[model samples]
Target: MTYSGAVKVGGAADVHELADLMISKVAVGPMNNNAYLLRCRATGEQLLVDAANEAETLLSLIGDDGIASVVTTHRHGDHWEALRAVVDATGARTYAGRHDAEGIPVATDVLVDDGDTVTVGRVTLTARHLVGHTPGSIALIYDDPHGHPHVFTGDCLFPGGVGNTWGDPEAFARLLGDVETKLFDTLPDETWVYPGHGNDTSLGAERPHLAEWRERGW
Candidate 1:
């Protein structure tokens, strides 16, 4: 299916995106996790971002696209359960944060930090560290050809809910603060966000909820 209003990156039309990004909802898992397939629209340089609980299905979904890399948002098993299979099938380099790299639940080839950027086709994704959801959770920010920025937030933030937390309440508060100060404040309020799960939302819509989030003690 063609994207009705896919934000175009201008020159990449000639550069050819080796793949397309497709989202899948696997409901049988603990969470109805969303997995994204990053296939090069031009060269078919496939990549998988956070395989859901169904590792095998994740493998089949790529279906010989010759995946080149796997990027995980955090250490949760439900999010990275298929890392091993995806890596085995495509020999793709895996990227994760240093702290969670141990529980990455699989081996990885790249360890990233905030401010780091990775290139695929003509797009650039910069990683930002958001600590509330997990100590090592990272959100990726990228600008489309029109200069509009988009963020791929792992589990730190969601459409209507932020992930459940286990650490200090103050830290969880700080996580929300990070979303405000680092993410929502830094990008255009129009920036669209693709969270690890749930439907997409924009910085503009969610920006207003920061105060509400603070009031509820989430």
Candidate 2:
């Protein structure tokens, strides 16, 4: 899976690049939807993954490199309520699949499908369709400069549970199975897992929970 326009960071700025994808978590709702800003150390370009409900905090924290684009893992408002304001402030385009992209409260400037690549500096993200919670939920998978894979799982698979499947339970089940078999299966167990919300975890910690997940005990 590859998404186009991973976002090229502009060079020659005084910006202190966020080395190794500096992770920041801001509690954005009663439910605590976590928003992330992945900035390229080399280029200073940032990718806004799952903009939470507070546009002011996200904008200020996102910093001056200027958000190249915003991406939504799923269509949940908690994950993207601030997108409209973020887009207005940063003038960054929003990326998602055509069907669900429009649900982000702003125009989705770019449409991505499975295997499309979205590039940010040297990071290339491939969008994988992990439909379950929504009709067109996607997972962004890419390898960093260290070659360690990073998955920006937006509600598809959390540390202990998966996203709710209001649209289709069967599809949600398939999504769960697909995540276990497809995305997680392709990477090493030590790969970093960046979910839409929650503290960062590793594949090592999360993989073993699949059985419990399937059994609804996690």
Candidate 3:
């Protein structure tokens, strides 16, 4: 389906393009986790984010576009439920953050840390480690040549506030600080945010209320 730049959820959404990259999202699993298929329009080389649940659906979404790599945002089960199946089927390279790589069911081909790059065809994504939801939770930043940057944040930052802190004071502090310094402080307000589950938002929308999120301690 054509997206016309509007945000969509569930089923097969619009294929959003930024510069040379094309991104398609489908919500899968019982938790409604989002699995994204990112393709470099220049070369058709692809990348899959999360591989979260629903192997069949994920595979269908992948179809003939064979992926070059799959990046697991964190170690959460819901995020990688289809990881093994997708990897086994496609023989794609797997990457995860160094601190949380051990928990993933599949052996990681590359252990990604802060500042690492994951390329899809002609497009490149920079990895930013966000430490709260999981010890090694990572958010990828894609600098679009034609527009503002786009970030794929797996359960770290959302539309209204940060991901669930589970009420840990230190964890909350780390998450808040990392998000503010690494993400909010660096990226532009127009940056598009794609989360692990459900919907999407912009850094501009979530920027003004950083204090409120901290004060509420969520």
For TM-score, the strongest prediction is 3
C-alpha lDDT score of every prediction, in listed order: 0.69, 0.71, 0.89
The number of clashing residue pairs in model 1 is 13
CA displacement after TM-score superposition, residue 119 of candidate 1 (Å): 2.2
Best-first order by TM-score: 3, 1, 2
Listed per model in order, the count of residue pairs whose N, CA or C atoms clash below 3 Å is 13, 15, 0
Residue 71, model 2: Cα distance from true site in angstroms: 0.6
- Show model 3 residue runs off by greater than 4 Å: 1-10
lDDT of 3 by residue, 1-218 (tens): 44533333345655786668889888785897888899988899989999988898888889886788999999989999999999999999999999999999899999999999999988989999999989999999999988899999999998888888799989999999999999999999999899987678899989999999999998
lDDT of 3 at 117: 94
Write candidate 2's Cα lDDT for 1-218 as tens digits: 22211211221112212345544444466556767677766676788788767787778778776789888877778878888888888999789865687676677888888778887665677888776777678888766666577787888877667777665658667878878776778888867676766555678877887877767622
What TM-score does structure 1 among the candidates reach? 0.84
Estimate the overall C-alpha local distance difference test score of candidate 2.
0.71
The candidate with the higher TM-score, 1 or 3, is 3
